[model samples]
Target: MAKLIRSIVVSAPSGTGKSTICRRLLAACPDIKFSVSLTSRTPRPNEINGKDYHFISHEDFQRRIDEGEFVEWVENYGQFYGTSVKVINDALNHGKDLLLDIEPRGAKAIKKQFPDAVFVFVLPPSPDELLKRLKKRGHESEEAIKIRFSQSNSELKEVLWYDYTIFNEDLETAVFQMISIYHAEKCKTNRLCGKIDRVFKI
Candidate 1:
């Protein structure tokens, strides 16, 4: 009668609002759990150790890589980041849906390991609009923004591989679309025996 947990990976280019949507989704849907990633980058001024990211030295990250603890690892903008296979397996084993907000490359890696995992790619309504939003943030220099834009192109190229591509023009609308997907995934026959039994219940 209970819903089985599914692992869903959400990937997007920078400024696609994946983080905000993920946070809102968790707040709106209590049963969903996020995959907290480990990074070799330093924690930002406002970031906490575990909540924002598990910051570690390059040496430790390499050690983890050698240990084969991560499901997938990537080096982006001179920093390393990865999602742990153990973390995902533990959450799913406990009947909690696991949501991973990762890069396209990482998403591809996770997909290879977990064939049934759902992949969602979030995109801005238009590339121009995306550029505008990135500029408005004013957090990075022009060079940095350009580099991110380049990566966005790379991320967009892999959109066809995803199961769903949501245009995040409006935050609320996008979140609702994702919610609909999450609910639909829960109703899968493999996840819901109750639904199968309901027809004969009468």
Candidate 2:
């Protein structure tokens, strides 16, 4: 009997430090696999293709979308982002715990297809704090920052539907909470059912 495999989808508004928390969790748990998403946007400095994202042209992205190659996809800030259906199936087939860092729209799309998957949201302590963090990035224009700030407000409302939420006031504490959530999810009845059945048969 094969045990159930689950994917964890996590999201946070930009500048909330969600990616840092995810990286820490991955470092702490080597067995978990991060699902690198496909994007039509150009890679930022230090971002590696296939590692950070599968960077592709807009035409290529739209072609895949037309072919139904993605489990979920969305266009944001004029860039396309998507998760391939193969990526999810491959990880589950190999018994890996898949982790996805995506936006609220993509996460909601995933939830429909993967009802058993755990959904988590990372949030800033306050709107003011989030704005401050966005400014500290030192790259975006003021208008860009304002747009993201508005988007964050909209995304924050989506948190109410998530399975769990973590406050990112402190990185260490947030990571601890995320890891703990992972451990707890691993022990859910749906996940353990196959093993329990096998033990009884023995």
Candidate 3:
């Protein structure tokens, strides 16, 4: 039997350094691949089309939904975002772990289909610290910052449902924690049963 490929789903409020941590984790683990999400929203200033997100038209996104091509999808702030089933299945079939950067709602959707996936929630040390980081970015107006700050509280509530929660106070520490989780999950009895059975000749 082929080895089981586990997936990691990470969700965090904006400015929690989730992306930075994910990048570092990917660099440290070559066998893991980041799952690129498809979004109907336009790309941000520093964002790349295929690298950051697969930008698609609202019409196209809706069509994909009707075709059942997405494993999980959600509409947030009047924009659609989804994870492609094909992309995730392909990685798993190749025996590669997949790292998904998704929001709470989408994560819930994915959980229904992939209950064994490791769900992690990243958080800031404090609400004030999160606000400070958002303001430092200077990418949005005061009003926009306020909106994100308010929304963050609701997002934080979802952490209780996640399997693991990591505070992004220190980038290196947070990345190390994530990598540790990945390695630990791979060693679970269910994941290693095939190897164990072969070794015991049972």
In order, the Cα lDDT scores of the candidates are: 0.88, 0.91, 0.91
Error of 3 at 198 (Å): 0.8
List model 3 lDDT by residue over 1-202, tens digit each: 4345468999999999999999998999988898999999988889998888999999999999999999999987688999999989898888888999999999999899889889999999999999999999887899989988998999999999999999998988998999999888887878878888899876
Flag the better candidate by lDDT, 1 or 3.
3
For residues 1-202, write the lDDT of model 1, one tens digit per residue. 5556478899989988888888888888878888899999987667789887899999999999999999999999999999988888888887788999899899889888888888999999999988988898887899989999988997799999899989999999999999888888877777677767686672
TM-score of each: 0.92, 0.95, 0.95
Model 2 misplaced stretches (Cα beyond 4 Å): 1-5
Candidate 3 to native Cα RMSD, angstroms: 1.5
The order by descending TM-score is 2, 3, 1
Cα deviation at 189, candidate 1, in Å, is 2.9
